[model samples]
Structures are given as structure tokens and as C-alpha cells.
Target: MERFKIRVIVTDQDVEKVALDVRPQTVEELKEIVRRHCNLQYEFNMMYEDPDFGNALCNLNNMDEVPAAATVKVVPLITSVSPEVTSNSSDISISSADTVILPSSSRTQGWPEVFSIPNFSVDVEFRLRQANLAYLKDNKTFKCPWDIKRNILQVLSEEIYKFDTYPDENRLHEVARALIGKHPCLTEAGCTDGCSGWKNSLYYKMGNFRTKLRKAGCAEVSINSSKNTPGVSKGLKRPKRCEVNFLPELPEREETLEAVRFLLAEEMKKKNPNATTVASKMDQTFSLRRREIVDVETPVETLKERWPALFTERQVFSEFNRIAATNLNDFFEALDRYTPKFVSIFKTKGGGVGETLTEFLQQIDLRKQDVTALRTLVLRGLPVLLGDDPSDFYKTCSVTDDDGVWAQVSIGLLTVVDEDAPVGPNVIHLEPVSTAIIIEGSVIMDDLKSLPEALCILFGLSYALHLDYPKSMKNTLNFIQKVMLGLGHNKLPPKLQSLKNVLLS
Candidate 1:
């Protein structure tokens, strides 16, 4: 390895001298050394005199270009406004070759003696006290150092008078503009045409440096930890809202669940315990509908892991799907059978028959009788698929059609259903209604002045259920329409009337 002796000079004063066996790899390493020796809050431009090029900073990246011995001059980007020490101090040199240099004032609080800026040569000390910036007085071109890019923060922390402690956010804009006006270098890059975009830069710089000073024990006590610290609010929390599921809770379809369980048990009797072999078999079995069921979680993964032998040649997945499909098909058949009976009940309650979704919506008025009749009929039909009462989940957000009622309903559904978590057989279509409504963008509005109560409930439920279980609820919507047509001012049956009262009341 090559070796070089180097001398670092700060503003014409010798600050450091060292012998290096390994040359610095990048300009940043040189900057780091300068920071260690000079305690400079702002960055410096490390320039050297080149024998052939006259004067310039050597790119350390190309080792062949560097000389055996070099003299590096440190030029501060943002010169200190005032020196803490007088110009004639001979003890300005900090000669410890390996010790890290820190600002004299950086010592933690309670030292009894307040530390300020360290002394420097008379020339450098006097130059800082003058009104003009050091670079401008020397007529040198601006070499914008990365570190000094945001040093305005340190200036505001140490020099600004109105701020007795850390400045509040309210004064940030004013301070930023003032600092930019005072120091031209603080102006944002590419803003040379009378536009100084330094406000954001100064604001962020000051905010970060304030925190740094506090952690370094250099921040003022008044602004450090007061309860009434400006720009910060204490003891505030986010507001809470009452949330209820829009889909009602229903009794479990025990017979249907039992059938599904029975199918799985039969499949387990045939399948091998090996997970890999069973997974391969399933992959081949569902090749046609593979895409649809690809992401579906295998509910039997735990059982397969614990007792892989029971799954030997098992048709668990196929049988479960077959049973579920059969149950769903049976539900549609029942809807076909019981639909006419419900239609008879609806007609006796005085609801109008509508051919289209729009017609149904326009006719439904928000009368107690109309709402009760429609709600009762829909709830009755819901049991065909759900096999239980869904009244509890009928809650909705305050927002109506315009704001998208399904949005709130979906949120409620997600809260109730942990889709990622494993569930047992009792988990019935967790968000069927809400999921369908969300995808279809359907909602029910209580617009008594324009829309009718019977039609609103009819279309709302029909659209939601039809979208949720398209194949199973295919004819259910038409059944609702027929029921509405049959309702023609005849008195409601006593059972339906009581049910209507339960809904509307």
C-alpha cells in the first residue's frame, strides 16, 4: 500500500497534520476528517494545490492521480456569524491526531461553566465578525457543500432573538423567508430568476436541528419540554364511531354443515396421509375451476399436518365442494317452490308489482305499512339460503345512497370476518350480502318524498342477494317482483302483519 503525509488547514490556520497509510476513498472521508478536526456545523470544500492543474480538489476515487504529500485547505460553506473567542488566541490548535473534535458548547448541561465556540486564529476570527459572508468577501465562487445546504437551521437555533426556546411552527414561514433574504446561498437550487424557494428547506432544517440540539443537551430549557410548547398539542386522541354489521346474524344451517362434514370425513377415508401427494391429486382434480379455488385456504391443512395418514387417497376437497354445491342448488329449488306462497302474502299487503329495478325503486314510498310489508317478505325469503333470522345484521351507517351505503356496510363485514384466520364449519358466507352490494354499488335510501318504501327494500335486497350468490339467487329477484305485483290493497295476513310491525316498529 502507498502512504502519504497530509496537512489540513482551516481558514489559513493549521488545524491538523497526519500520515496516512491508506488514502481516503471518497471526498466524503476527507469531509469527515475536517468535521472531526474543526467542529464545523457547516460543511467545507476541501481544495488542494495541484502541480499541473494549479489549484483544485483531487478526486480521491482515482488513486493514481494523488501525490505522495498533499496540503488540503478547508473552506467553510456558511461562515460563522460571530466567534465565541477573541482573535488573538494561540491555543486555537487542537493537535490530538486521533481524538474526535466536538463543539466546545456540546458538553452536556450542568458543567457549571458554560462552553461556547472554541478559539481560532486572529484572521479567521475577525473575518466571521464582519457583516459580509466569508465567501462573498473573498470573491470566491459558491461551492455548495452538502452539509451547509441546511445549516440555516443551526443559525436560527443559536442566533434568533425572538425565540427564547425552540421556535414554534407558526414562525417557521417568516423565519425561512428572512433567512433566505439574509443569506443568498440558502435559496433553493434551480431558482435563480428572482424566485427563492428556500422556505420548505429552512423549515425542515430548523425542525430537525431543534430535536438534535435537545438530544445533545445544547437546547434551551424554556423551549425544550414545556407543556404549552407551541406547534404541538397534548392529550388529544382520534375520534371513535359506533360500528354495526349491516348483514344480520343468522342461526347456523346445522343440517347443511353436517352434510359438508360428512363428505370431508368420507374423503379422508380414501386419501393418503402424504401432503405432497394429496396436493398433487387436488391440483389435477380442480384443473378446470382451479383458478377460482386457487387462492381459497385449505380448511383441512392443520388436520392433514397432524394426521397426514388419514388424508391418504382422500377425496376431502372434492366431496366438500360437491356437498356445498348441492346445498346451494337445493336452496334455489326451495326458492322456486316457496316463492309463490310469499308472493301471495305480499299481494295481500298492498305492494305494487314492478317489471324493472328502476320501476321498483321509484314506487316504494317510506310509509310504515309499505316498509313493514316489504321487509317482512324479504326476511322470510332470506331463511331459504341463510336458514336463520338475519335481523340483527340489518344495521346501517347514517349515510344513504349518494354516499355509497355499501362502503360502510363492507367495513362492518370486514370487522366481523377474519378471512385470513382459520374458521370451523359454522362460518356461513361471512360477507355475502355486503360483498355483493359493494361489488354492485347498490344501496337503499329512505327518500320518502320520491321513492316508495316497499320498492326500496325490494330492489336493495334483490340486487344484494343476486350478486352475492348469483346462481342460487337467480330466480329469487323475479319472485320478489311477482310478490310485489300480487300485493294489491288486500289486508295483510295476521302473521305477516305482526312480522311487519316487528320490522317497521
Candidate 2:
């Protein structure tokens, strides 16, 4: 028996040169030799570079057939038991380490434990089966046909849409890696991991798929379509700060659009409406409302006339629940929980803004103030901290001149009063007085107790009516959407991330 050296790669940074006395007769024998040499105690799958496919790593099924001096990669299986793991004979365990964690800031958050690829069409499956059989018979590299690849992508795109309508770059790569892992024969020749090409193809396929979905009246994709978002040259309107049920499908069978609309209208007419019934009707009519708001781009006045209940405080919170899937109470509780930290962070700054924040903080006795007052203070100070001009977001004008100011304002917190309360310059102190949320120069929600409530309702209405974040308060709202409410994309902007890091620290 002649001795030869085979390079074993345990990880990207870990490689070992193993001396084999003789060619292993089976894959188990090869694993035993690798375990002895590398001192690996855990069960791991092996993939050896195949000269037949320009040295791309292929699953090492038969050690007897493996080429001499092959480079073998050892992939460790996840020790934690999960239902998502596929126990199929052909399935290889994808290491947790292999998954690319998005947004380096959030290290704990990564890809799902299992990336499930749905079955292809019958015809496509038949073709793939034949190709896979050929590859198994004589080590033939399966050249994926265009039609077969298209069908595979179609199925995968559908699966991706089930999670997110707009999957990021890392997500697309994860899907491609999962595809090649399940179907090793589809590994691209000359590629390092064998799925770079697949990733690129998937990116384009997703774009094409979204285009098709947009044309087919998919409200989620349609809202971000080019035609809907004119003048948005840089980026389309998408869920940046949260995973909103932007445009959910209409309720099936029992709850038709007309039926739900009628039910909702009847409930709205009640002097003291049933909260539970109103909430259910609002949820049922989510798709209908989304269509009018997103597709039709209905005016605020018209929307109020059609869906009057939507403007009510109860319905505003209900709409938020439908879109964000979070309770209004929970939002306030979270705001209250983080108020002290935010206040501390704000106090650390020393500048004009800091000085202003100091004055704002001094006006409110932290010990004496209720949760609502603290939350209001924090919300007001947030825009200032984030360097966002609060003039547009939180507007203050006398009751006499309110009509002119409301007309000019697009969306914000509007405070109309008989007399100017002397709190401080540029400071709108939180009072138990009536305030309103102005959208498109119209008061959609009114008779709010404080700024925080108005802000929460305004944030919810932003989603309900598909309105963009106000330019002046973009950062502040984004922070609220991403950090406070915990809705939106994983990757926070640098400014927000920095603030988050400080807050977390």
C-alpha cells in the first residue's frame, strides 16, 4: 500500500494535511482517517474536489472513486435539534457558521435554521431526475437547462416571497447555497463554492419575478413599482424600518371585500362601537384599504369619507396592529422602558442641540412625570437628538392661525391653542390638551391627549395610507420604526446603528 497526502479543510481558516496509507475503500473509512488526523469529535459531512468538474467540491459519497490528492471540506452538523433539519439520505447539514449573518451590528440574527426549497413542476422534476441520475452513474456534471433553471427559480422565488417580498443580497446567497447543497449535481464548474453563478442568476430572477408579480396586481410589489413611485430615482418605496403587512391578501370565503366594507361602515355608524368588531372588520378590510391608499393614492379627505372609522384613535391603533402586528400598549411600554437610556444619551451631548435638550429635560421633573409624559418628552427630544428638524414633525401655531399652518403641513403633529404656554423657545411642552395628526394638509386624527399618542397614530397612519416618512423627521421616525417598534429591515442605517449601539451600550 502506497502512502499519499490529502488536504482536509475543516473550515475556511482550518486546513490539515493528512497522510493516507492506502486509498480508503469507503466514505466511512475516509471519515475515520480524517477524524484520527484532524482530532474532530463531531459528526461532519465531507466534500472532495472533483477533477471531473474542474475541481469544484462535490459530496464525497464513495471514497473508492475519489481522486488522489483531493481537497476535502469537513462540514460540521448543527448539534441543536430542530424540526427544520431534513433527515433525507441525500440531504447534507448546512453548518450554522456557513450562513452569512446580515447587518454585522446584529450578530445574533442570522439566516433561518433551514432554507426550504419547494418542489419544481412535474415536467421540470422529471428532467432534473434524469440529469441527477446521469451524474450519479458516471460522475457527469449536470448542465442545468434554461427551462429547468427557470422553473427552479420560480419555485424558489415563491418560497422567498412567503417570508419577504424584498429579500436582501445575503438572503439571495443563502437560498443559492441551499439549492446547490441539496442538489450537488447542479454545482457550477470552476466556481469556488459552486453557487456564485446561481446567486447572480437568482438576483436577476427575483427582479423578473417581482416584475411579473407587480403586473399581476400583487399589492406589496405593486406599491413599489416604478409607475407608482415617480421621482424616486434613488430607491423605491419599500419597508425599510419594519416588516409591515404592507398589503395583505383579502380575507377568504366568509369575508368578501364588499361584505367587509359594509360591515365596517355599519360598525362605524354606532355611537359607541364594539372595539372587537371594529378591529376584526379593519383587519378584514386591510387589503381593500391598501388598494385605495397605495394604488389609487386617494386623498386624505376622500379616505376619511370612505373609511371614517380608520381615522378614529381605536381604529388608528387597529390599523397599526394590522400593518405592524404590534400592540399600541406594547409600543408605549417599550418607549417607557428605553426612556431613561435615551435621556441619559441625550444628556451626554454638549452643543446647541444638547443645550436645547437640557432645557427640555429640565422642564419635566422625571420623578413626578407619568409614563405618558416621559414618553412624550423622549419622542420630542428624539428628532433633536437625531439632528432632524422637528418644525415639520411637531408643529405649534395659535388656534386662530391653525388653518393656514395645517394647509401648508403635509404630515405631522399639529398643536392648536388659544394662548402660547411659556415653556421655552422652540419647545412644545406635553400637555393634556387636544392635538391632531395632519396628513396631506388634512386632520385625519384628532382629540389626542399628548404628542406621543399623536406620534404613534401618525406612524400607524403612515403605513395605513402608504405615506413616506416626512423628510424633516426621517431619522427620528426610522429610529422609532426600527428600534422602538422593532419593525422593518434588519440592517439599520449607520446613524441609527450608531445611536442604537450607544443606547445598547
Q: For residue 109, what is the lDDT in candidate 1? A: 18
lDDT of 1 by residue, 1-505 (tens): 6677677776433457767677777678767866775665544466665767775665344434556787776764432222333122332322211111213221111111122323333333343334236435763334444433333234344433212233334344455555445444334456553223445554555554544443443323212334335567553111000001111111224354334334444444674544555454343333112111222222233334433332321233222222111111232334344544444444444322222222322333425334333443443343333223322223233222244434444211111223353332223221222321122223322222211222233233322222232333323333332233221122454544443444334
TM-scores of the candidates in the order shown: 0.20, 0.65
Task: For model 1, state the Cα shift of residue 189 in Å.
Answer: 7.6
| Model 2 stretches astray by more than 4 angstroms | 1-152, 177-195, 211-244, 248-256, 259-263, 398-402, 416-420, 423-425
**Per-residue lDDT for 7-53 in model 2, tens only?**
99985557999876778888898898998888653457899899988
TM-score of 2: 0.65
lDDT of 1 at 93: 28
lDDT of 2 at 52: 84
- Which ten-residue region of model 1 has the weakest summed lDDT? 238-247
Worst 10 residues of 2 by lDDT: 98-107
